[model samples]
Target chain A: MSKTLAIGPFNDAERAALSDEFSPVFLAKPDELAGLTDDQRAAATAVAYKGHHAFGAAQMDLLPNVGIVANFGVGYDAIDVHAAAARSIKVTNTPDVLNDDVADLAVAMLLMQCREMEQASAWARSGNWKSKGEYRLNRKASGGTVGIVGLGRIGREIADRLAAFKMDIHYFARSEKTTPGWQYHGDPVSLARAVDFLVIALVGGKDTENFVSAEVIEALGPRGVVVNISRGSTVDEAALLDALENGKIAGAGLDVFLNEPAIDDRFYKLDNVVIQPHQGSGTVETRAAMAKLQRDNIAAHHAGKALLTPVN
Target chain B: MSKTLAIGPFNDAERAALSDEFSPVFLAKPDELAGLTDDQRAAATAVAYKGHHAFGAAQMDLLPNVGIVANFGVGYDAIDVHAAAARSIKVTNTPDVLNDDVADLAVAMLLMQCREMEQASAWARSGNWKSKGEYRLNRKASGGTVGIVGLGRIGREIADRLAAFKMDIHYFARSEKTTPGWQYHGDPVSLARAVDFLVIALVGGKDTENFVSAEVIEALGPRGVVVNISRGSTVDEAALLDALENGKIAGAGLDVFLNEPAIDDRFYKLDNVVIQPHQGSGTVETRAAMAKLQRDNIAAHHAGKALLTPVN
Candidate 1:
C-alpha cells in the first residue's frame, strides 16, 4: 500500500525523482486516466500540472483522493485555486526563485530598445565597416525615468538594477508605498507621464485587467518606451499598435502577450520594437530551481510541515 | 586685413563661436578652393572637414597655408594624419570625451542581445500581445567573462562598467601590457575563446583589418556573443554571417558598420542579433563636450601650445 502520485510534462529529472518516491501514475492527458484501478486511484496523494494550459475543473475530477496540487512555476494562473480549495486540497506554487532571472531580462529589454543593439549587429554582418559614415545614436538608458506598474518582487528587482544605472525610479501601486528613492504614482496614467521608460510588473488579476490603455500610451508621449514583463492582458493591444504606428510612443519591450505562440504580422515589420517568445522565467538555471522547489514542497507536505509557498 | 580661416562643416555652436575671432571661409569641397589667391589663402590658419567621406591626398593640395585640421569627433581616419603631417600642419582629434557615451552604448547593446529585449518589444507592438506571452529568463551578465578587442580609452570605460556588473574582464592588445583586473590576450581568437562576450573597442587601423574572422567566431562557440563598438572592418562580415546562420555563436550587438545607411536583409531576420545605426557617441552631453574639445584644440594650436590630442 504505497502512496500514489500523478505527474506529466515534468522535466525528465523531476519526473524520474518523483517516481522513485511514490507509486507513480503517469497520465499523458487529463482525459486519459479512465483505465486506472479504483484502489490505486483512491491512494493518490499528489498531482503535478506542468503544461501551459489550464487544468480545467473537469480534470480535477480524475484525482478525487489527491490532497496536493504542486505547480511547477511561479505563474499558477492556469490552476483554479478556488476549486482546489473547495476539496480541502493544498495548492502550491514555486515563487521567489525566478525573481533575479526575470528582473535581469527586464533591464536587458529596456537597454536594447534604448540602444538599438540589433541594427548595429546587422551592419557588422554586412561587411560595410566604414570609418566615416552616417550612424544614428540610439537613446541612452542612464539618467532617465523608469516607471514600474507594479512594485512586487520582480518590479523591486528591476528597480534595484535601474538604480545601478542612476535612473530615477517611480511606481504605480494599488496603494502608496514608502520605498526610498522610489516615487509613488496613483495610477498608470500618472506613471506614464512621470517616466521615460514604463515597465509593467503587476500581477494578472481582475482588478488589473487592461491596465495600460490608449490613454496611458498617449500620456507616455513620443519619447517614452514601455516594457511589459507582466501578463499580456494588462495592456490594450490595439492601443499599443496605434501608438507605435503613429509614433505617439517611442518604442516598447514586451516579454508577455495576451495570446502566445501565435504572433501577428505587424510585429515583423517594425524596426523600432524588440520581440521575444515570452521567456521571463525560461532560463535553465531558473527552471531547474523551480522544479526542485516543487519537489521540496511535496516532500514537506508529506512530512506534515508547513508548505513553502502555500495558497491560503 | 581680416584673419581668413577655412572652415568645413561644423556644428552651429562652433560656427557661431568662431565668427568673433576670424573671417570664416566655408567650402563645399576642399579641392574647389585650389585656385584661391596665395594672399587670400595665407590667412587660412585652420580648415575643418565634416563630411562622411575621407579626404585623401588629392584634397590636401587645396589647403596650402592651413595650420591645423581640427576634427569634430574622436575618429580622424577621414583626414589622413600622414598627409597633414607631411605639410607641417597639425592634426587634432576630440577623444576621451566620447568614451563614456560609447561605452554606455556598448553595454546597452550587449544586454539587449543577451536578454532578447527587442523581440519582447515587438510582441507588445503587434496586436497579438497574447501570442508573445511572458518573459523567459535567458542569461545573466553578472559573473560572466567580458573580452575586449582593444584596450584604448573607450575599452577601459567598458571594463569599468563590466566591473560594476561583476564580470571578469579580459582584453586583446597589439602589445602585452598589465592592467588591474584585466588579463591581456595577444590575438583575437584566444580572446574570443576565453570570453562569454567579446567587445570590439579597437581603433580602425591597418593592424586591425579583419581581426575577427570565421576562426574567431568559431572559437566563441554557441554560448558566446560578440559586441562590436569599433569599426566594421575589424570583423570578417562573411565569416560572421556564416557563423550566425550556422549557430556557431550565440548572438551579436554592433554599433559601427562597413557601409553607411545600408544593412543586409539576413541580419534583419535573425532573432539573436541586436543592431543600431552606428551611434556610439550620439548623446547630447557627449557631443557638446566633443565640440568644445575641438575648439580648445584649435585655440591651443593658435597659441603655439601643445595640442590636446595631436597626431604624431
Candidate 2:
C-alpha cells in the first residue's frame, strides 16, 4: 500500500534502498503498470523509472495518481515528455551526477582511436614487439583541433579536459555559448570542416535524429575522426560505416551505435575504429551516484519538497 | 671516410638529413665502433647516437677524435655523461620536443587501464555486447588522486592535463618544485602511499634504477595502479608483475618494461594491464620533431654554437 511504483531492473542495493525509504511496489518494466492491481496503480504517486524502454501516454494512463516520473539516467529521451506534460505529470532526471564519467569515456575513446592502442596492446601481448622490431608511429592526438557537436553539461566537461590537452576547441550548438576562446560554428557541417576530431554530444531523440548527417561526416575529411558519446540516432551510421570502410574519413570512436549491442558487423573488421559498449556513464562510483540521485528525487517528491533534479 | 659517425638505425628521412648535411658514416650499434679503421676513428669528430645501448668509455675510446655525442632521445642515460665529460666529449640530447606525445600516452594508458576500454571495446567488437547485456562497471579515473613519481617537464604536462580532469595532483621529485597546491612527497614510497594512480616519470640512469622499488609497489596497496612511461630501469618489474599477478595491486599500464621488445611473458597473461610497445614518443609528428632536434644539436656542435640541448 505504498505510494511509489518502481519500474525496470533495479539492482539489489537500489531495490533495498527504494523499499526502505518509500515501501515502493517494484516492477521489471514500465508496461507492468497495466498488470498492477487497481489499488497498487491508484496508490502510486511517484514512479521510480529505469531502463531505456519507452514510457508513453498509454503507460502513464495506468498510474493515474503518479505525479512524477523519476528517471535513472540523465537523458530522458525515451520518456515521452509531451505525454507526461499532457497528463500534468512532472519528470525528474539524474543529470550532472554522471557528467564526469561520460566526459571521461569520450576522451578515452578518442585517445584509444588516435593511439591505435588496441592494436599496440595486442602487439605487445602477442610478443610481436620482439618480432616486429618497433611499432609504426601514429598521428598525435594532443593539441589537435576538436569539434564538439553539442555544448551541454557533458560536452562542456569534455571540452574543458581537452582544452588542457592544448586542443583548439570548435563547437556547434543552436546558439553561441559564452565559453571564451572556443570557436562557435552555426552548423554541424561547418564544425566538422574545422577540425580533425569531431565529437557528438547531442541530446537523444527525433530532433537530433541523423543530426550528424552524411554531409557533416563528409566534411570531416580523410584525416578526421568522429567520437560519438551521444545516442546512435544522432549520427548517420550507414554513412559512417561506408566512410570508415572506404577511407572517406580516417576513423571513428563510437560508444553509441544504431541498434547497438547488435552493432554493425562491419565495425568488427576495422582496425581504425575503437568500439565501446554505450558505457558513457557506466562507472561504479558514477552509477551509484546516479542511483542515489534518482532515489533522492523520488524522496523529495514523497516528502512534498521540490524535486532534486526536475525536468518537465 | 666521414668525420661524423652516425650509430644505430636511422630512418630514411633521418639518414637523408644526416647524409645531406654531415656525410656521416653509419654503424648499426655502439659495439660496431670497434670495427672502424684507425683512420676512420681518428677522423670522426661527431657521433650522431640513437638506440638505448650503453655508450660508455669502451664505446668512446674507439672514436678518439669524437668531440660530441648528439643523442636522438631525451634521456641520455645510455650515454655516460660523466665518462664523456672526462674525455672532453660534449653530449647533447633531444628533449622537450617529445614531452607532449609522452604525456599524452601516459594519460591515455591510465584512462585505458581505469575504464577497461580494451575489454569493453573487445566486447563491443566481438558481438558480446549483444549477448552479454551491459559491460561491467569500472572505476572512475577523473578527479582521483594521482601521484607523479617525478615532476619533470613531461611529468608536469601529464599533471596539467589530469588537473583539468579535476585530479588531485601529488608528486615526488629530487626537491620540492615551485608548483603551487600540488602535493609533493619527499620519497617514492610516501608518494606511492598518497595516491591511487602512480605514474613514473623519473629520468633513467643508475641513480633512478629501481626507483619504483618493491617497497614502493607494496605501499601502493590493492586499489593502486602503476603507470610507467619512463625507462624500465626505473621500476622493479619483477615486483610489479607479482603484484599484478597476485592482485596485491589493482593493475598496471606499462609502456616500457625490462628488456622490452623481449618483455616478460607474464605480462601477456594479465587482463588488468594495458601493455603498450614503449611508444611514448612513438608518434609520426613527435618522432620527426625529435629527429630534427637531434640533427639540430649535431649542427650546433659542428658550428661551435653551444650544443642546442647539451647534457655535458
DockQ of each: 0.29, 0.86
Worst 10 residues of 2 chain B by lDDT: B124-133
Q: TM-scores of all models?
A: 0.76, 0.97
- Tens-place lDDT per residue, model 1, A64-167, is 87778888777677778878888888888888888866776777778767766555544444544344443444566777898999998888878876776668
Task: Specify the highest-TM-score model's number.
Answer: 2
Q: DockQ of candidate 2?
A: 0.86
Error of 1 at A76 (Å): 2.2
Candidate 1 CA-lDDT value: 0.74
lDDT at A12, model 1 = 63
Q: Give candidate 2 regions above 4 Å deviation.
A: none
**Top-scoring candidate (lDDT):** 2
lDDT of 1 by residue, B1-312 (tens): 334454465655657766655546666556656766677677777765554566656666665767788877787777887888888878888888788678878888787677666665544555444553444446766567989888888888888767656578899988866687588899888998999899999887566778888898888989889889888788988788788888989889877667554655576677887776677887656766776777777778778788888775
Error of 1 at B230 (Å): 1.5
What's the TM-score of candidate 1 when only chain A is evaluated?
Answer: 0.90
